[model samples]
Target: MKRWRHLALLLMLMTLALLALPAYLERAELQLWLLGPAWCG
Candidate 1:
């Protein structure tokens, strides 16, 4: 539903931000960005 889509978008943005950071909050952020679409889908 709409909520899921919104959450997915938010996570996508987080993933992008985390990816662009020189020091990430966690290394896993990269994996989340790489796989978020499949996981979200």
Candidate 2:
């Protein structure tokens, strides 16, 4: 296998992870932040 092809595959996997994790975290943070006011009060 060539170097660029391997690098491209690695980059593609990284981009996919970035897209998935942020959306997951966003939903998680929204839930946590919403509960913060009640918990703190």
- Range of the 10 consecutive residues with the lowest summed lDDT in candidate 1: 19-28
Name the TM-score of candidate 2. Answer: 0.50
lDDT of 1 at 24: 59
Give the per-residue lDDT of model 1 (tens digit) for 1-41. 99999999999999998777765545578879988999999
Q: Each candidate: RMSD to true structure?
A: 12.5, 3.8
The alpha-carbon lDDT assigned to residue 12 of candidate 2 equals 100
By TM-score, the best candidate is 1
Give lDDT tens digits, candidate 2, residues 1-41: 69999999999999999989989899989988999899899
The ten-residue window of minimal lDDT in model 2 covers 31-40
